[model samples]
Target: MPISRSFRCSVFIGVSLDGFIARRDGDLHWLTSRGEAAGSDLGYEEFIAGIDAVVMGRGTYEPGRSYDPWPHEGRHCAVLSSTLPPDADPRVTVHRDLGTLLRELEERGTKSVYVDGGQVIRTFLREGLIDELTITTVPVLIGTGLPLFGPTGGDMPLVHLATRVFGAGVVQSSYAVDRTT
Candidate 1:
């Protein structure tokens, strides 16, 4: 039955209009150089409150885990990597199999899941597992860097939900997934 179950997964990320999430060397210099009042993050607090767990890739871990903030402290965090140590964090778990991970979460009656990281979000989109995507696009553009949406095998459809404008020239858009034919 194709692991039939209803699971709600969301992607909350910041990307440049050209589609890069960060500079080539993983430096978010472009993002940091922007004005202090740039971009609207008004809905972020509410968005975070609606999720039960979060999944992210190695590259995405640094920003969220740095400075002892413990971004996902209260929520279950799944780091998708085969190389990470088994005992990485008390609140975080490493996962290699996406299916197994979702199944486990579903079994626990998890209501919402947040998928972070460019690669991780792409994977969820490709697998038709993501239900919503909320992307904030900054004004600046990085010529060569890590892209938010890499080359996918096919097209995915999305229904526009809402948009928010932040300080400086930042814009945020939200979309609900539409099953692709």
Candidate 2:
């Protein structure tokens, strides 16, 4: 049976072996240190290419703001936060509720959405909104840090789709949320 929805929501993120997205101080040095070989992004380029927009939490948006040229340049990016100031970029939108954000995206004819950030992803998963997830796990383990999966109420089953191994023991896996189960 084909899954049907007004818009598809997906997650593409990197996590430590122990399931941490960033270190104690919100540093992604563990991930950034793994320099990419020429013309290699472990399928990230392909993944982002298919996404129509991005939805992230305040935690994720703040760090991205530090980038010389915001990472999500051309994409329609929605920051889910109530405390942050309004976005200066016209492409970026500030939303307080995920439902409203999704509705707005649907109205804008968004077909696929890339849901990011630890807290944002967790919330989407808890609400049974995520359609798919592609998680790349790095080799190193940060004992204390921000975990990717915080208590999400109940199990959300997934069907394995694909897996690829990159240099330095980085493993990327994709899964489709098994909503029927």
Candidate 3:
């Protein structure tokens, strides 16, 4: 299925001013610095409230899956992975392909989905499935760490929608997808 067939999907992430999402050791301490306005979540709460479902990468969902209290209590959550045990909760469906997963979500009347996790977001963006992106750039930079985006096959130019200063040094910019390449 073509990416356009899906109802809608967006990516929201926070990166350092230099484009690192976490340290080389996967520590997110740089993103938690109060002096750099890292405490702000870049309006993710509002964004999550507006989404009908959330699709995340296996690595991203793994840690949260072991939570004593699952966070996505009432929302449809899909973990993009074929390795997940089948005994997992029925509410959580494991998928191997992004296209197939998207098709299923569309059939289920999912109006919108939140594509989260670094690798997962990159995959969605690379496939031209993301309709919008809301990225918050923190003021600090991690010399070595995971970047918000990696090399993709093509160039994706975005149209600036709006920007907001959340608190202190945290500023989020919203962009619309330029589908007409």
Whichever of 1 and 3 has more lDDT, that candidate is: 3
Quote each prediction's TM-score.
0.90, 0.91, 0.88
Worst 10 residues of 1 by lDDT: 33-42
lDDT tens per residue, model 3, 22-106: 7776777668573245455567778888888889987778767878778777889988887887557676888888878887898
lDDT of each: 0.79, 0.83, 0.80
Sorted on TM-score, best first, the list reads: 2, 1, 3
User: By lDDT, is 2 or 3 better?
Assistant: 2
Write candidate 2's Cα lDDT for 116-138 as tens digits: 89999998888888899999888
Residue 12 in model 3: lDDT: 81
Total clashing pairs for each candidate? 4, 0, 0
RMSD of each: 2.1, 2.8, 2.3
The most accurate candidate by TM-score is 2
Cα miss at 173, model 3 (Å)? 0.4
